[model samples]
Target: MQDLEIIASAGASFRPGDIPPPPDGGIEAWTQVAMGWIVIFATWGYVNSFGSFQAHYTSTLPQSPFQISWIGSIQVWFTFFGSAFSGRLLDAGFWIPTFLVGAGLQLIGIFMMSLSTSYWHLMITQGVVTGIGGGIIFAPSLALVATYFEKRRGIAIGLVTTGNSLGGTVYPLVVRALLPSIGMPWTARVLGFINLAGFILVAIFMRPRLPPRQTGPIIDWSAFRDTLYVSYVGGLFFFVWSVYYTFYYLASFGQQEVGMSFADSSLITTIINAVGLPTRVLIPVLADRIGPLNTIAPAALCVAIVAYTWVAVHDVAGVYIFSIFYGIASGAFQSLMPTGVASITTRLDTIGSKSHWGSYLGCAVEYTLRGAIGARESFEGWLEGKD
Candidate 1:
């Protein structure tokens, strides 16, 4: 928090030309980029698959939609909330401890989730345990990935961000495949093993290149006065709220309202993630040359357009069309966010505060939006009105 405030305060006074150059590319740097990518793949990949669980639970459990959503909401919210402290820890050079502990807890959480038979059980295991761990890992994956590249940072971070898209894209299919024969418990176990493998590699390769910034007052509160930071944070708050709410609930919406089979409904998630994969990578490359914010605004606008189109859809064809357009637009928004934040911040020490932690603060509001949407009675009536 103070880390970002101080940086935002400093960056507010500096000209863009004064920003220092990064190594841009080196063997070690790209290697670290790979490490960041893998951690994101495991951490976010797990969270991104929650739409599958959300849809499945709506049918199997007696829990209301609002109640079932708490598990996923908690899981995702912690990923944002925990990162504020984890970002500080990374700045303090505690990467190894943070990474390993997060991996262990995440694995345990995934395994524990497999045993869940009730709402509270899932809320504790998947929501609390795994969510906290995911947040811890998520901080560095965004923060550290930036330390290695500057000129092409948009694409580099974009590549790592694709972990969100790729994991979302692939894990749904993996869970769908495993659920029939192996069931949820064994299926979760398989994912746990994969998490162990991916994170082990991250543990070995992920290192903090910069020494800890221990001398400061921690976070400077005054950075909130910076207009750019304020605008950036405010914009993302509403943007992510809508994106997350839509993606998380989309499968169940397809199933119950659109008459998609469980398999077909689940496939909506797969398609959204799949369409985002290439867009995540390629769009950031565009952001690099054209500018991240310029790249982000148009894409963000398109997301708004497609989201409105979601209501008009009465069949799979309309859903697919919405998925394709929304996926590309939202993918650009996700991939460009770090780049956009970093572009304005002149200091490395505060970059995490400005980007990861700042966005986390913005994300808290999303839970409110999600909770509103989670209440199926009201949300369904709204959806019915759309028809």
Candidate 2:
């Protein structure tokens, strides 16, 4: 009890007026910023890298493509669902414990996945375990970044999101290179070790500037009543739906419609991530200068445009061009989402509302899954017409 008081006092010291102005080029400030990025990178990278695993699972398990996608979909579901539980835990000042729990689950999940020979094994290990772990890590990391930066929030979030882009680019290539040599089981174990190290660094260094008690409850349910807040959430749902649909299906579309080799289709995915990396950085910087919504609305419109263009383009070069433009637009939407949400709330204290995060993101993922299903059905219908 006494120890809790001491921790509470330390947290109280970080109140807006109490914190000293940041030092110019201060090592500590930069270090904190780096920690934020590292956490984001590790969590999102693991999440985005699902494609590599999904492809391998479908091929090895002899399941339909849709069944393989369920592995990722369930993973995404738990990632969002657990956010509500973890967010409140974070608000209570349990950041390190929360991160540690997430890291442990992720490691266990990876190991489980390494040993699995059945579909149910993959679902339990990857979908339930890793998804829950990702949720635990993601909520606190995002909340902590909010604690660290006020003026530079947009840019800071942008930098962190770039980690996801990097993971998307690198993870597929790594899996491709290793699958034939080390094989899936050993490869899973090796990547698990890498994730363990990254997450440990995050747990140790990713302390919130304002301690949990000072931040209030972890779950801020009242955020739902705000009209603008609802809009922000809705926008995020549509954005994620459109983006993930494109991410998961574009390669398959190219391979089937454009008659590209599997290797060429994979290159298109790389191109998307490559274009996304710079836009992730550039868009948020621009958002910080203009209003976040000012930047976001236009980008969302562009994504809609690109979605239709992707549907029309059946040639390799056209798909490549779509990948670049769509990737940039998607990156901009993602980089600005949290900033836009943060803007709608009057008190920053309520920003970590766990239920809202879960519902908003879960809805997005759900809609994305629906979009992918619909696109697949459409493609099959088109093929039937050609026959």
Candidate 2 local lDDT, 241-267, one digit each (tens): 545656666666676567776556666
TM of each candidate vs. truth: 0.91, 0.85
Candidate 1 error regions (>4 Å): 1-21, 217-220, 372-379, 384-387
lDDT of 1 by residue, 13-102 (tens): 333464344567888778788888888888877787788888888889997656677788788788878776677677667788888888
Best by TM-score: 1
Candidate 2: residue 17 Cα off by (Å)? 5.5
Local distance difference test values of all predictions, in order:
0.76, 0.68
Candidate 2, residue 316: CA error in Å?
Answer: 3.0
Residue pairs in collision within model 2: 88-218
RMSD of each: 4.2, 6.9
